[model samples]
Target: MSRIFKVAVIGGGIGRAHIAEGYSARPDLFEVVVLCDIDPVRLGNVGKQFGIARQVASFDEVLAMPDIDIIDICTPPSLHLEQCLAALAAGKHVVCEKPLVGSLAEVDRLIAAAHGAKGRLMPIFQYRFGNGLQKARHIIQQGLAGKPYLATIETAWNRDAAYYSVPWRGRFATELGGALLGHAIHAHDLLSYLMGPVASVFARTATLVNPIEVEDTATASLEMANGALASLSVTLGSARELSRLRLCFEHVTFQSALEPYAPANDPWHIIPNSKAAATAIDAALADWRFVPSRFAGLFAAMHTALVDGSELPVTLQDARNSLELVTALYHSAEQRLPVDLPLRPDHPAYGSWLPEPFRG
Candidate 1:
């Protein structure tokens, strides 16, 4: 029997979903011992809904607790670096949300700190765990997909003024970025997850959707490391929401479902160029196991990783890859030029990707 891991979840917003779908799904693997939120109202509501008897209003209190084995930081983008580092310092495993930190430099710092810390850090990219996406990943891994070709990734979702009315959003200082960082990040991460690393990026971003400081629409051209090209289009103004990935490989083409939030779910349109290719794809997925969508699947994998000392499903480096792409996209848009990947310390935006006015 696997020993249940105790978790303390901070930030009652997305944190609640993590508790509901993740910890609740695997009662044998995890237990939500505490729920922490600065807002007492939110804390009480989420705590009561989840049946978590222990509730705390302060982060310091959560940190000081000795029984909590994992600290899940679902707080805002700005708080992630500090909160995650502190949790690691307290010898507690950490799971943080997207746009892990403000800058590439900060991500590097956390990467360095993680090396010496007692607890492991796992970044959230739950979209990568869906069954349809997993099968595509398996097919590619088995070399049934042959060489990579072109791919089109799209993230078009609605976000009105009310959504940005939250105090921290729609500004570079708080939200860190617009749709690219907050919404489409998961889709972009999926791009890297299956298609491999990006070699260069040429992007253009605009704020035409909402009357806010940050951009809501964007388009980017990418050169994958394996010599494949990809086009990324993102907009928060879509009337009909969609999150889709269509990958055209040398032997087959894989397309995700049009579901906005859970595009990785089944019904993916997978087309093989030949009978032999179709047979190979079938053989590859013959023994495919269930991969629960979103948080449930991610947490199960995390539990196994924690117990058996395996590599985390999503590591800080994966966060780095996501952020580096964001940085390059921002830089390219601002400079009106294509930017190369694997940004170094010497890059101007290495410290912070915010436009000049937004950087504090």
Candidate 2:
């Protein structure tokens, strides 16, 4: 029998969801042993709500628990790197929420730390785990989608002053970034996941909504490594919220559901260019097996990878690639020039992507 991992979730806000997916959703694979948060009230509330008997106010307590095999980080962006480093050093496997680190340099540092640590780190990109997106990935990997041509991706959602009322929501120091980094990152990640690496990016940004310090709207054009062209647009000012993706390949065109949050879940339209092509797509999808969607699916895959010693469903390099695009988009928009791929340590935005005033 495989060993069941014991988990300690930190930060009670988003951590509540992690408890639901990691512990409640897969009891056989994971045991929710502890909960940690800075706020006693919120922590107690979440612990009682989830029936988690053990609760602690300090992350140090979480790290010191010998029974806790995994440290699930659902904290603010500012605390992620520190918590991840400490958890890994304590010989605990880690699962962290998105916008992994604030900058490319921090990501590099975490990658190096992960290599030397006894434990492994898995960054969450739950959108990639959805059934519909998985089917799309299978079709493309099986060579049924043919050569990619173009992709149009949009992450449009409304966020007014009330949404940013949370102290960290709009600040670069805490939230890390505005719409491009925080809001649309998952959509951009899905784009790269489907089409592969981006070769270059040219973008423009605006602070048209909610008088925030960071941009609330942005647009960018991308050239994929495979020679495919793509465009990305993001806004927190839209009247109607939607996350959409349209991919046009040589053999078929794939359109995702208009789900604002769970766009990759299901009910996608996979249209072929011809009747023969349609047959091929149908054959490819016939072999598709359903996986649980969102956080549950991510945790399930992680459980398999940890127990079976298989490759992670999402990798550190995948996180790096996503951050590379984020860096490029910021560099492009700030410089008013197209930025190229593989941003290195020498890049101006390597240490931090935020502009001068926002860097503090």
Across residues 1-360, which tens digit of lDDT does each residue of candidate 1 receive? Answer: 898999999999999989988998899999999999989999989999989989998899999999999999999999999998899999899999887999999999999999998899999999998889989999999999999999899999999989988899998888999989999999999999999999999999999999999999999999999999999999999999999999999999999999998988997988999999999999988888988999999999999999999999998889999999999999999999999988999999999999988887
Once model 1 is optimally superposed onto the true structure by TM-score, how far is the C-alpha of residue 220 displaced, in angstroms?
0.3
Ten residues in sequence with the least summed lDDT for candidate 1: 282-291
The TM-score between candidate 2 and the true structure equals: 0.97
Model 1: lDDT of residue 217: 97
The C-alpha stretches of model 1 lying farther than 4 A from their native spots are none
RMSD of 1: 0.7
TM-scores of the candidates in the order shown: 0.99, 0.97
> Residue 339 of candidate 1: its Cα lDDT?
99
